[model samples]
Target: MDVSLGTVFVSEIMGTAMLLLLGGGVVANVILPKTKGFNSGWIVITFGWGLGVFAGVYAAYKSGAHLNFAVTIGLLANGAAEYAPGVAVTFASTMVYLAGEMVGAFLGAILVFLAYKKHFDEDADPGTKLAVFSTGPAVRNYGWNFVTEVIGTFVLVFIIIAFGKTPSGLGPLAVALLVVGIGLSLGGPTGYAINPNRDLGPRIAHALLPIKGKGSSDWGYAWVPVLGPIVGGAIAGLVATAYVV
Candidate 1:
């Protein structure tokens, strides 16, 4: 059942693309002006992202659904060998996964914008429009924001690794629910962007796209999501390997 590197790449591309598509689509639906789901509240947004994870996992099953780089990095930090059943972990393979995920995430944001074209065109706060594509702090404290992301991502990767040990058969659904819980509990401060690709890729799209009044991409806060998740995921991998798993 070993898949080629091309399969892994394409699988991740499709999966991550599907992820951001649904995830971003939800934010756009809720926050964009004149949309049916506009101002629908936080509960709707959390569930939307959860469902996105569910769908993305199935789409990327071929690559063991490491749709989030945090998961991938966590696994590597845990000292595992293969990314999937047949894909051996190597420098090239790691790079390929990262590349595929970045490409897929960027493409996914484009798809979300296209889906919500009229809304993106509507008169909305530039920050609101940006929020549709990426996460930002509700409070804008860099140090605390990074801590929030790290803690959330730690729970994510730690539980994910632990899930492998449990005999329950929920699979991706469980991960989806975990994300929902995280969003509800930990999302208030930083919107729970525990995945770097989930934030950075779409933020890049926000910057490049021709949306009306899309505003600044918030590059100043960008490092938090990226670096925090990486550090969190790496720590989770090590901790899980040491005790939890």
Candidate 2:
């Protein structure tokens, strides 16, 4: 169904909010002390993020859920050239959707903080506390970090867009499985953030939220998550479209 920009933006906020809620919540549970998921390992993180995407899509379907900036840009780059107004509309819509996602992610981080308040207090390591709400690489090297995120997000957006006619509907299980497959296959190196707003919004919340001795929010590496996904998604879209023969 065709949707106005206003409607799509609202859905992006709502959907991305839910994405962060589940995605961040899982990270918190796994990393925070005195929780069932404490130290549950990478499998949980992968699954939670996968499920988060499914939930976000479900909520945002009515408004056309382009929850990630990469997907929006990829879509624009691939399909917008046909119409003069398409570039402007795509740019505007992407900005609006990204803004909504940021709001949603902050809200989700707030909820995670509330849910795991005791855990944060009990945990003494500042790094652990901050990590629950945001992302940091297992290795601090910039080159690898960017490559990992780029490859993962590139595959994700490419596969999703190439899946078929997106104006058509996907069953809930199909959507969830798409993410799960992405996670299981490609999530080993960096936590797949495919969406820039998802990482930054929650990172902002982590910085603002009251936590005892929480470490730096790691803003230095923030741009990678944003730009990497955009590059990856754009490449994927172009590659996918080019091979249609």
Candidate 3:
């Protein structure tokens, strides 16, 4: 089936929105005190991210909803998508997809924020406050933090493309399992901000959202989630291609 540009854009938006809701919502629930999901732990994050993938993919499977930058670049690198037809079309469409994802991510964060607004106000730890928006290491360090994100994202895309076979075959249940495993195994280090849209969009939302004395958003570590996933996904796709070929 031929994919339409409009469909692609809408699917990306919807999928990303769901991702943010599941992922960012979990953070809000865990970090916010006296709430139901408060301190729910890594398992919750893993499950939430897994289900987020299922929900996003389910919503946008028809329109090539990738919901992750790494997947987008990997598809282009492997000639899976016709991104070479026209420069303007390719560039504009890709940027549009990213934009849609950011919007979706923001929407998800907003939902989580609203869901736990009262809790946010009640909570008073700076670290906890930051957790509601973006990820940070259990023990802070520059090198390991980047590595964790890279490894986590690499595993995520590899499974999605190879095991899950999304947008082609397989089902959400399997896709969700792949994510669950990644979260359980690789999510410990940096909370597994595997998708750029998933991290940056919600981070942006956190900055904009009114949360009373919300501390710095950790902009310095921002690029890790953004760049790490892209590089890791590219490598995984190349490796997959070599093996398959």
Candidate 4:
């Protein structure tokens, strides 16, 4: 219960690294030519991401598994005292989690690229390459894209809070299933980038990495996923706090 900030940072880094590794790996598998899982469809991606959450949560359970920055913000807003005993959720600890997540996300993207380096060279579409790292809107509409991210992330954090109330303590599995459900239902428009770090970190990696034929990072539409999730997560936290209390 009484965890040090160092412990929290290490745990989150390891957990989030795994989260992005598997999550990004799935996209690479689907989009990259010559890969075994190429063209596996959206269902594979949703399941892969769900499983990534499961693994990351288990890996970071000691740190409350706040793998996503949005989740961290939501949990704190909802009252960390209720869930994390003796673990002071201060500004410093928040920074630890954020730093860990960002670094882990970037590392994970690098690992994915390494794993599929040959396929990346074989693949010609920059959009497909970029999709492995970050998200893009199907129709490229910023207004609607922001709305979709808000709704999707609201469902994610809201349902996660609901799961916390259950006595069964379904833990990571429940959250993983929640992610899958969100993806299946609401992922169409913006690829369901419910986590800001999940998008930004890998996007940064894609930009930094020297992948041949890779296209623009699409910085113009990046703010929607980041800002929308923050807003949605904050709203969910406020709503959950009020409803629960």
Candidate 5:
């Protein structure tokens, strides 16, 4: 399972870019007017994200398919002991993973916006447009929103670690299903960001993009998605190390 840092960077960048492209693309499709999948609802969104994870993981499996920064952090924390020995989870590699994921996520959001350029112009709702790029709380309560994100991301990273014991081929599918389940069951509160890169990168893109009628990037609520998932992933990693390693 040894891979060079260069491979990790390239794979993470490519895979995470694809992940955001498809995942954000789905939100754009359902929310933006003139799109074929307009108003297709949450089920479609959950499936889209799951499929996005599937595609991203398949493309990045050579570097352990860590398209998510939270996942990479979780594995690094786990590797502190013996849970993931000889896996090259060094500080330098972690930085590379983080850098790649951030860039990829930003680029992916840009791709989605370009692909749906016509819809952005036609759509008049700023909230809906922003939704395509980032997650927002259904209730707008920061404390509760943070809790929901923590619980959702804990389930995500913990289950991913648990699934590592399964057959190699089943890993991608299993994790995808886990994402779908998280979205369906726990996503109602905060749209199930579950990964810091997935939310922040696109939110940054939303801020920078020149989409017509795009509203505030909601920078006020942005920290929850990023910090909650990292805290949750760290907790999952520590628990997994204590229990499994």
Candidate 6:
């Protein structure tokens, strides 16, 4: 069952939008003031993101659920021939997947902002407000922060590649659990912005949105999340090709 590239693009967008919507919503609920889920702690956020991945995988099933560019690049670096069954792995298709993921993430962040509009206006720390939109480190060291993201993303993409090679009938649920595990285990460092689009797109949204009292988007540290994931994912792909036999 072959499909057009355009269809693949939209599929990714829908899936990723669903992902960010729920994932970001959880953050907003837990961190933002005057919400029922306030102070719900890390477990809720982790599971929310995991469930988000589960839903997103199904939504983008047509595009092999490449909701993150890291996944797409990992496939490419692993010498993949197709993005999905019919979507050939070419430069154009790569661009399409990335574009869809970014747009979807942007849209999803907007949804989260809208959903939590009341909370955002209820007077909160600028850092907390920013956290609702994007990730920040517990510590302020860029070098270590970058390393943490790299290590976390390596585990993410590596395990993801392993998932593709193994058959468990778990499908998207497997990826969801992996995300949860990543968050529980490694998310403390940088909130595990293991996917570039997952971090950057919503970050751009934070900068543009009219959220009252929202402060700096923390653009200075943005490159860490973006580049660390890409590098980690690429390494995972290469290692998977050689080792995951």
Local accuracy by lDDT, each model: 0.89, 0.73, 0.73, 0.85, 0.84, 0.88
Clashes of each: 0, 0, 0, 0, 0, 0
TM-score of 3: 0.89
> What digit string (tens of lDDT, one per residue) describes model 5 on residues 161-198?
76583212348888889899999999999999999999
Span of 10 residues, lowest total lDDT, candidate 3: 80-89
- Overlapping backbone residue pairs in candidate 3 total 0
lDDT of 4 by residue, 71-116 (tens): 8777777776633445677887778889988888889889999999
Once fitted onto the true fold, the runs of candidate 2 whose alpha carbons sit more than 4 angstroms away are 80-88, 165-171
Off by over 4 Å in 3: 82-89, 164-168
Candidate 6 C-alpha lDDT tens digits along 148-215: 88888888777877767321123888889988999999999899989899999999999999989989
* Superposed Cα deviation of residue 74, candidate 3 (Å): 1.7
Worst 10 residues of 2 by lDDT: 80-89
In model 4, pairs of residues that clash are: none
Model 5: per-residue Cα lDDT at residue 113: 94
Say which prediction, candidate 1 or candidate 4, comes out ahead on TM-score.
1
Cα deviation of 14 in candidate 6 (Å)? 0.5
Which ten residues in a row are the worst by lDDT in model 6?
Answer: 161-170
lDDT string for model 3 (95-171, tens) is: 77677777788888888888877888884876687787787777778787888887887776666567533432446
lDDT of 1: 0.89
Deviation in angstroms for 225 in model 4? Answer: 1.2
Winner of 4 and 5 under TM-score: 4
Q: How many backbone clashes does candidate 1 have?
A: 0
**Model 2 TM-score?**
0.90
